[model samples]
Target: MFLKSYTGADDARIYHNEGDCVVRYVKEQCNRHPTNWPVEPGTIVAAYAAHTRQTLYLEQKDFCNKNHPLGLGKPGKQPQRSVILPMLTPNNRVLAIMEFDKDETGFKEEKIHYALAYGSWVTAALIRKGIRESLRDAKEYNATILNCLKCFLHEKLTLNQCISAIMITMREFIRAEKVIFYHIIADKKLDADIYEATSYNRDIFTKVSRKIDLRKDFLMKDVAENHVVVNIHKGDEEQDFKKYNITDPAINSVLCVPIGNPKRLLGIVKVINKVDHPMFFDIDLVNVSNAGMYCTSIIFYTAIGKQLDNTITIANKQKVTLTRHMIPCIHDIIQFRSRPITKPPPYYLSFDWYPTKDELSRDLLADYVWWMFNDLFEGDVFMEKFDVFVLMCKKGYRKTSSYHNFEHAFCATHCMFVIVRTCSQKFSYLEQMALMCAMLCHDIDHPGNTNPFLKASEHPLSKLYKFAFLENHHSNVTRILINHCKIFDHLAPDDYKAMVDDMHRLIVATDLAKHFRKKKYLDDLVKDKRFDDSLPAHKMHLKSIIMTTCDLSGQFKPFDRTREITFSLYIELYKEGDWLKSKGLPVHSTLDRTRYLDIPQDQVNFLSMVVIPCVQLLVQMVPVLKDPYTLSCNNLDIWKRVSFSKLFH
Candidate 1:
């Protein structure tokens, strides 16, 4: 529809077009130009052909003969003769026309250049539009995948189910042939046992299940170590297939993607072959792999939940037995200590309540107290020296109502045991009895509640005893119980004071706020190797630390048992925190509500960080504590794996 125009001093013609085939017409103009320049016609034509190919959508070969044709073919199958031509494209199919006059030189050359430039502009515009469309499509696809993953997370599906669901979505989206999941196990093995092989290839899956050791397989090892997706197209058989034993003829291509856990190698997802068309897998593989990893994590967490539930059941049974026997002994000791002040013996201590007359006897109380002492202390030296201390408390009680009952009696017994264990052979009978009596009465008439209750009641004990000197009040109670109680009328003066000091140190350590300070002191003493001494002071400190250690040793109990006890303790602490908050009081930092429930994740992490270390430290300090330490450690490790396994939903 357009014509070429000529403008030059030399005799040359030009051809051009206004249609889509402008570049082809430009070639015709070049061919018609005079070939008398310094450059050879063939060279100029080749250069023009290359330029046209780069700037326009025209084929390089078709453009070659525009200016000058290179005869490129066999003799019999001769190529077309050289000529410049206008092209027609009325029906979207180009028709070549190699007609042009021989004398259109300089003007033809200018027209050829103009046509080439116009064609280039059109091609560039089309390319830019194509790139924009591709970007939009990619963004939409990514949004879809992210939305799907969020849904899976919200649903809380197990890792396997999540992976399978994701694979189905991805497979349908991508139209892939098969998606195979492979998990990496400890010892660097691939576990194909827990896999989702989608594509309706039941027969192939059966074969794979029977023969694959996923863990030991070479392909899994490579995926885990590299932590990347490996794409293999057909004919790229350079990999040592013999080593992997992957002779399956059906596998023409592979996309092996590593599913990485934040902490370790979770597994791999191998998408095998492409449907509809043969295309090489690329970075899109990572999208599928990430989905698989999410699934694996869900499965792992589920397993841990089951294990914890079982452990809690076992722990509850143990707690019932412990509470029944231990609480009664504790109750009796409390009653014995309060006997001196009440004068009539507390209602709980009367014949109607206890019913047994022997329940209040010194010998029976002494024997029962000694048995508990042995259970806790685990030695014989304290039992033999107990009688001398009992007599001193009896002697001291005649002067006052302080050391009369079993509460002071037990406290005195505990102190005497501490001194006896520490002083061993050097312990004096009178000193042991006085100390025992003082320890027994230290908490006599004790209100069941601790500091928070004291503050709330505005009790006389709370006012007389400021928080800073609360330990002094305990000392005062011990002195009063021993001096005033008629039951301890048999104690010597010097023995009583020493007993008060030992008992004072032990009871005051029960304050949880002082836990860190006590730990620091014990750590320092242990570092100094102070256990080698038999001094009463060192012995008393050791006994105090041991008692504190037991008090805080709830976490080290068997996993099941500890959970039940800890949950109960957690609830109790939570209630206390609530009360303190209501009263506008500052609760302890550790009693924050966020930490009270022992959530599974927190519990597992605590076992790894706090519980294990504490138990190990106890065993290191006292080798005899090894059984509980080892048991707890083993259980924790098992639970961790179980938790991980269950999470792989």
Candidate 2:
């Protein structure tokens, strides 16, 4: 006889002969069913076998006085014994249970093995059926997501129409009772719009309100602040509902997905009451996460479109074009000429390299960059356009900064040239070119201020970028310069796209806030010896580390050069701090001029924490990086000595 273990809405049941007999028990539910069917011996044995994925034998002596469908309870023509075998997939997933009963003749041990052999056939059949169903479901899911994307991209659709289309698609896919979109109206306010897809053809807009305050709602606050998905379901339903402020008894479960990254909160998608399952599963979370990402771009572009319209209005009223135009014929006026490029001096590739005043005055630094690119690319790509591109990047750098100026960019680029040249086999030609280009324009148009200062002072850049203001602005400027110079126009579309993507990623890696996490990831890769140069992900991590190491190359330079660079950075930061003090804002201790005495110790700590570990990892990955690694170690020692001496002074 077949005993199938079935999980019901409120309880679990072991059904004998396809529901000819059933023994019910509560499953993950505290409340008891009104018709409390007594648990039978066969039912218990079958459920146990299914749960443990083990076979069980119950003798007639073990049967209780409870009612049994096989007549064991009354003892007339009853079975003397029963054996329950669990049917399982290859991976041990329970599929069903097979129970056998025998009278006084009893079942021999060999017959039990025969029954087990037959159960495997049933398990295989169930697995095949499951695979077919899963494939069908996956295809449907993909189609729904594609339709949602198409609805979003349709140019003729209104914003309301697009949102409604998305909601309807999500509701049917997830079998949700309702989908409510909580559009973040402002910093502390949200507009809740509810839509119910009772029929696939139509959506009912049951409610719309813009009065919800995020500060007062714990559920939205948690999702927005932490950027987490909140899934609530049965067993803990009462407690979860009370904690998240769900007041309706009808709503038993919820899935709330946040729409943006940690830096920005675009909106939230709340799917209420999953109909097909006890709770939202992993597949549901995956779908909602993807939908949230699409919504982020949609909302961002919609906002940008409005801003662009307003910007045009302002430009029209001022009788001016929106683009920033340089003086006409300025290049001719400056008479900047491109000279024949040659290989850099030996020291230029070493940490001890430092350019003199004559090099800066003669504008020979650009030549060094040109030579590096030409050498790496074998004079194939960017031969003629490179000079123009480098010149444009130079012009983009602001003249007002103490550090993070053109000279700094040049130093960083020179460091990159050394790395790519040493590890030539690890990178392709395009990657080498991208690495050099990223270093060249990484700090273009710098304002000589940190990101936090910009945010605290409410700088214009802060308004334009909610996070990573400096890096994002620098990347944007780099793209503009590249387009203006048309340096990459020679490459095919796919190659050009890859180059641009790599360049942006490399430039963004300069942000030190992300340094520690990236270092740990690289550390793991190195520790496990799992880094394969052929893997794109592994190569990108190495490239990103290279970018950071090159950006901080000054730290491992000769002692005198390192001190000069450090002081220049301190000067720029203190200047910002002085302005902050003037405006009655607090200053970070490192940036505060009053704490200048802590410079040596701070340098020691920075070398210990950031520079040494980074270069050491690079050396482990690429042995040629030992020179810089050794230099960083020496710099840490020097700083330690300096800090000790300061106590006596």
| Candidate closest to the true structure, highest lDDT | 2
lDDT of each: 0.47, 0.72
- TM-score for each prediction? 0.37, 0.52
In model 1, the worst 10-residue window by lDDT is 347-356
**Which portions of model 1 show Cα errors greater than 4 Å?**
1-160, 173-175, 185-188, 198-212, 215-217, 224-229, 236-245, 261-263, 275-282, 324-649
TM-score of candidate 2 against the unseen true structure: 0.52
So what's the TM-score on candidate 1?
0.37
Kindly list the per-residue Cα lDDT of model 2 for residues 454-547, writing each as its tens digit.
8888888889876678888888778777776678999999999999888988888898877676778889889999987689888888888899
Candidate 1, 1-649: lDDT as tens digits: 2333232222122322222222222235547432221112353332332323222222324534545454221113322322333232222212222222223232345555655444345445544554587467656656765665666668754444455566666665555677776655544544544465634753223113432565466666677666755676556453645545667888766677776653576767777766532343453565566656665565566566778888788766654543232223434455544454222223321111221334544345544444434443344354444433343333323222222234333433433353344444543554444344334443443433456556675766678666623445556544444333333343456644555556566656544455445566656767787654367665555555444443434454445545544454445456667777888987763445755433445566756765565545555565645543565576566556554234324
Off by over 4 Å in 2: 1-308, 311-343, 583-585, 643-649
Report, for all candidates in order, the number of backbone clashes. 79, 0
Error of 1 at 201 (Å): 8.4
